[model samples]
Target chain A: MSEPLLSVRNLTMRFGGLTAVDDVSFDADQGAITAVIGPNGAGKTTLFNCLTGFYRPSSGALHLQAAGHVHRLERMQGHRIARRARVARTFQNIRLFPGMTALENLLIAQHNDLMRASGFTFLGIFGWPGYRRAEAAAVEKARYWLARMGMEERGDDLAGQLPYGAQRRLEIARAMCTEPVLLCLDEPAAGLNPRESAELNQILLLIRREHGCGILLIEHDMSVVMGISDRVVVLEYGRKIAEGTPAEVSRDPNVIRAYLGEEESAA
Target chain B: MTVPAMLRDAGLAALVALALALPVVGIRTVDTGAVLGLDYRFGWVAIAVGIVFGGRLTALLLYDRLPRGPRRIRTKGLAGRSRTLVRYAAVAFIVFAAALPQLPFSDRYVVDTATQVLIYVMLGWGLNVVVGLAGLLDLGYVAFYAVGAYSYALLAKNFGLSFWECLPLAGAFAAFFGILLGFPVLRLRGDYLAIVTLGFGEMIRILLINWTTLTGGPNGLTSIPRPDFFGLAFTRSPAAGETAFHEFFGLAFSTQHRITFLYYLILILALVTGWAVERMRRLPVGRAWEALREDEIACQSLGINRTTTKLTAFAIGASFGGFAGSFFATRQGFISPESFTFIESATILAIVVLGGMGSQVGVVLAATVLVLLPEVFRDLAHYRMMVFGLAMVLIMVWRPTGFVTQRTPTVRLSDFTPDPGAAR
Candidate 1:
């Protein structure tokens, strides 16, 4: 088989004397959904942060293979990770530019492409032909994504004014506009209702099947983690306990104990 | 509320005013030729209390009658109607402004005051870019104005450069200073950024004062050359073979000719500034600025380099300020550090805030109100500033956001319809 899309080796992140993500490593394959499951404070977010260049790992390497080149994400800046490594992420808490329109939020994700076409804004200021063409293409892409999210009618509305569930979906659509090789979503299902979660499942499946990009999702919702994820990596207190297909991981004895707590010997 | 509540509120305000005015205004010291004596002015105090009571009661009644609760969502029809209204108002204002100098009643004083108003309008637009659009609180904007003025003065005095030649140079110099200021305060935001910019303004003023050889200390540079109409001097007599403006135009030499010329020069500059800024708002860089203002972290997440985006705003905003400064130097034929002070920056910032952040027409209206309020109250003598402050307070109370707070989207979907095949 071809090499995995992302390779995280001995990733360790610490704060002072405490190790938040302790030597945890995993590979997320291309065109597949990889769900990272853990209990509270299992260093799930810390690990995501380390992967996205939000935090410097205490020790280890994060290698992303794209365009026939290996990019070390650990050394890059937060923006560089998104720009160069093509790794896009959505925050656990929605971070859309609240005042901007839904379409503009998605357009901003296409900033690098537009910026290059605009000649870093000097040419764009004159509304040059090249810049105008790029902008039209950008608007078209934004329109497509807004349509994909079933939000074509609400593209002009401000992101903040959208209902909570729509805001989550808009955030995902915005990340997709960047055309990332690897998309990291932190609890994309956190506040979603069952219907919305079910809708979100379909969207994720569609993205994997159509876009063929790697997805790294961190979710507490068991239905979402087990329902659609091709692979599940369970972490208990920053240590990986099990890694396998959803059925195998669900059946693992250690995974069940870590989630339910030692089987209660008295019971 | 109810009439009784309004009366009670007004009564409480009146009582507070009376309590405060009794010590400060009701009684005063008088010196006779032989002795100092106390004089009672209870009648004036009563009059003041009565006025306050009546004004507050009226204000409360007016506010009570205004629409309350959630505002109705603006429909496309309503938005289009408002846009048309604004367009009509803008056209009317431009016509009035363009005709002011040529109007039969326009005297030198009238032209000069109008010119002053235009200068503030230009500065207001420039500051609007930084404070309103970029969401960077800059209390040191006048430093760029000062840089532009000094650069023009020094360059013209030392290098013999003409006003037209020095204008862009001055703007570039101010923009350079803007970038210099931009670098240090990059990590800072909001109030901290404001304080640093305030210090940066004072630093420039202090530097001008101490840099005796360069800036001429507190005495300032004088005899700066007046701008000409493309090699034609505005003076009555031509210098050697050079042509005078009146001679070239075959008209009588009047000092009003130069005044009108300067007036039109600034009018053109101000118009160009407004036009360019409006266009820039539609550009990607401008969108980035508004996005940065909305959320910096979101911008970083989207792969936007924060440093360049911010520095571009500062540079562009400062360039306009610099252009205004050079024009000011040419018009006055004299410039000093005294002209560019913290008060100037405050006044410019006030125009931006009062106009409605990021609204071009709003800046024009706010500048007119702020500049005219003081001139209109000149007869108030020592109470002029008090009247001006009161008017500002009234405006703020009436329209907390601004006189015009509508935010038209930079780009609308209707501007470009998507193809049927585009959707995946």
Candidate 2:
């Protein structure tokens, strides 16, 4: 009933003669999980890239209303989309700073806020009281995320050394440190074991409930999609084929056809 | 060990020995005043070949006989012990450096060599900020050094500014040049970035040569004022209305005093640079640089402005280079484009790389080795470079990451209380 936090209208991305994301539109509300599901090359990633300002849409309007401000994400640069529009993302492949410790990775995610507190390193260099306080606060925030991700003990260890599951959680924790109004996760559950996937679902649920940030997830795993997503948007051939509740989308003929193929659909 | 394997190794060593001996031993000519004659040192070659054969056989036998698991465990233990030993060695080195001038046998030559070492140490540390911490692969670092030197030279010559006055101004000018160079190469990465920076360095050098009026051209500026001890010149005799440093201190007016004074000045500057870089490592900007080094896309996703982050790294790194350059000009009492060359950049880079990128102590150790090794082998003349190259190759083979591979993280979550209440 309340206004959706992010409204995407007629978003399209073209590469040469091919359309990667074609006229796809969706509304993701705050305090909810929105899953975008598609097979390989179904343009799910392109759509995510468009939303996060990694790619400029051929034609679209992305309106993100956060903290009583509406941001035109299409007009913003990639970094501006993250900093100004309050959009944070985790890559399909975990892109943690491998050499940096898990804690440093999280702290760096809070760079803009800390940079502001440090007066762009001028205050920080001198170890001003204000910068010290902010730094302490940042460490505290990083510690909290590390603890929540069950990585408190491994906080001092390099991110690359962490187990795959922990790295995935750390990536999400890093994005969370930016305090994004909208969190976009690309295949966070990919390569995760069943137990890790269940844990991820719980974490996402907890984030939606407590943090109250809207989550946009792209997942190939149907169990993850059906288990937690409040709404499902099925994309096929770079176009939205179905949009409804998980159960409704699962029952949709187009969605079934997309997943099972024409021969299996006929059977 | 298999007999066949041992024989194969010996055969390989024999081949190597033959190749080595063929040029110098087999094909040798001698002149005995009146006549030129071909001579054979086959006996010497045979002895060398025999030694190589024996060495390879012994190595293979020893390697085969060693217990693998215990050897690995012993090495692991040794690694841990060596890390602590290295720390203690570093402290010992610093103490020795600090007490060198006060030592009984430290002459002007020793002091001057030490000063040169310190300058390279400072340059290595500065370039480390860009290449090591920021992972920018800057191949034109000497350009900043030139900028600083020229700035000080021109400022002191035309404006009559003191060394102290021109020092910071030179640093600032170099930082400006750093930004100027950084702007065009922001989008470049790795090898491409290296080529552009190399071109930029040469461009600056060429400009210095051609721009005869400003930089004194190829001749360079001369008689640049030396940095004084708060208006106390380290001169043979006091200038009008001023006492010489040695005279003011009631010490003998020896040239060693000035050399010692220069050494201490550089030591202080180098220490300050080290201190600043260490502090900046824990700062947000520094962390951002490291972050960008690790992953650029991730950095952008986290809202770090890549351009600003990179520019700051360049500016800060170049500023230190500038400081070292001005000190160099002051020390030499002259400036020339020749001093700032691709070789200097390569040498500085070698120090940083050999030291281990992002390791401060590593830079000091590397700078010492790189600067002093050549001087120590000055008698070897033509052979020194070959030895130097061999040493570098050996080091790379032994530890490609650097002499110091481990890096201390800038921030640790364990340092803070993991309080959920505080987190809120």
Candidate 3:
């Protein structure tokens, strides 16, 4: 009803001659959770990258009307996409600055704020009250995000030292610190135990309800996806075969044929 | 994040505080000026200057050294803090620097040595941008130095410009050449960049050596005017009333005034150098440089224009080198190709490396040691470089990563704050 917070129109991604993603389009409603599901190499991550400014689409338009402005995602670069579009993302394979502590990782995500804190001078770092205030605010924001992720006690620990599940959560926390309107998660539930997966579901639900944020996740874990996703957009070989409510998509022949186990398809 | 900044800050502060306090606090001055801040007549002066600089630098990084309370500086938050701190620190520096030169001191030579040290420190900071921050190992930083020197000499001789007048022109010309050198080697990196830069340095020197009509060939440029006070040179003049510099101060000018003036000049310059580099580290370009240093791919992924970042690193670095170069030429009232050599680059590189790649304090420490050690070893000048070479090897063997144990992350300080996100 509110013009779908973000709209992707005929998005296609090509790597030289190979087409990784072709003619994919979807509408992500404002403040709704949308799950993009596929097997390995379904171009889910590629699509996420395109949307987040890591890869500029070969052709298509991505528009976002959030916080009172229309932004063309295709027109932005990676950092700008993160900053201007307010699009924050977690990588499929975690990319926390290895040497940095878990908390430092979150702060880096808030880099745009540092630009404001500098006041464009070395002298400004000490003399400018604005810089000091901005610094304190950024620290406050980071603290809020870290605590929300249940990493308050382990903030001093290195990101690499965090357990697999904690690292996954850290990634999400890092992204949230950017204050994004849309949070893109790539296999956030991967490598997590059932308990962790359930915890992750709770976290996502909280993010959706509390922040009113939109989530676009790429997950192969059927239980987690079915358990949490409000809507499922099934991607088969980079093509969307079924898009509907989780139950409806699960019942669709194409989705069952491609994603369900062999016995289920046979039945 | 680089070693030089950290090492310079740490080493300089330690040396300065120790050197000055030791004599007064009864840390007996060992007669020989060869070991432990004891070399040369001005050995203690070198140490005093070293420590003050080091201490200031330490104060800047004090946040990093202190015990980081668990989770207070979260890894997630660290990235933000590291990047932002540089920006904030830079701003504070510029404003405070306005009142610096007026700070009074007793020994004049301490000030002079401090100035020379400051000049080198600036040069080291610039070279750190290329080799330390950008991950470009340039062995030809002196090329910019040569360019600045020649630019100043030729400008003054041809245009009748004053020392102050030639300063900016020297910087601009050096920056122009830095970019010119950068354009052709856009694809090169690491060792290749080093070789190209090495060649660039040699090329400048050779040109200066051969350009007889302009650079005066090997004989060197002479009659170069020294820096003046308004229109008055610091020379002894009957009209000035006082033979001793202190008389004007109502105390006595003595030999110390000359040292005092030169010391303050370079100190201010060094302070400016610190300020400029710190400021640049925060600008969009500065982040690009750090990103480039850490991971070129990520830097590109972030949409940082590498071409601009690399060129700016070069241009900025070269501009500082030029500043030092101009200062050097003016200090001696002479210019020659002999001073601009590959070895000079290597020595400065050693300062950057020994100090810690991107750490400003580290390099200052390295510079203080690298420059003053040899001068202090004036008795063994013949074996000075040999001793220096061995010391470098020893330090590398001991602390291969650098004298400073940790590097400042590219992220800012906010990450250290308790994060509500983590708690949830």
Assess every candidate by TM-score: 0.93, 0.93, 0.73
Candidate 2 chain B minimal-lDDT segment of 10 residues: B71-80
Candidate 2 per-residue C-alpha lDDT over B1-424 given as tens digits, one digit per residue, 9 for 90 to 100: 6989799978898889888876756766789789998888888888878888998888888888877774221212343356577669767977988999999998888899999999999999899999999999999999999999888878887888998899899999999999999999999999999999999999999999999978888998898887788889888867799988888889887888788889999998998898799889989989999998999999999889999999999999999999999999988998888999899999999999999999998999899899888888889876688678768898898787788776877875656665557777
The positional error of residue B306 in candidate 1, measured at the CA in angstroms, is 0.6
In order, candidate lDDTs are 0.90, 0.90, 0.75
Q: Candidate 3, residues B148-208: lDDT per residue as tens digits?
A: 8888877887788888899999999999999999998877988888888888888888988
Error of 1 at B215 (Å): 0.6
CA lDDT, candidate 3, residue B318: 89
Q: Under CAPRI classification, how is model 2 graded?
A: high
Model 2 TM-score (2 dp): 0.93
Worst 10 residues of 1 chain B by lDDT: B71-80
Please tell me which model should have the higher DockQ, number 1 or number 2: 2
Candidate 3 residues lying further than 4 Å off, grouped into runs, are A67-70, A101-104, A122-126, A154-164, A259-267, B1-118, B172-220, B236-260, B275-292, B295-315, B372-387, B408-424
Candidate 3: residue A140 lDDT (0-100) = 72
Cα deviation at B34, candidate 1, in Å, is 15
Compute the DockQ of candidate 2.
0.83
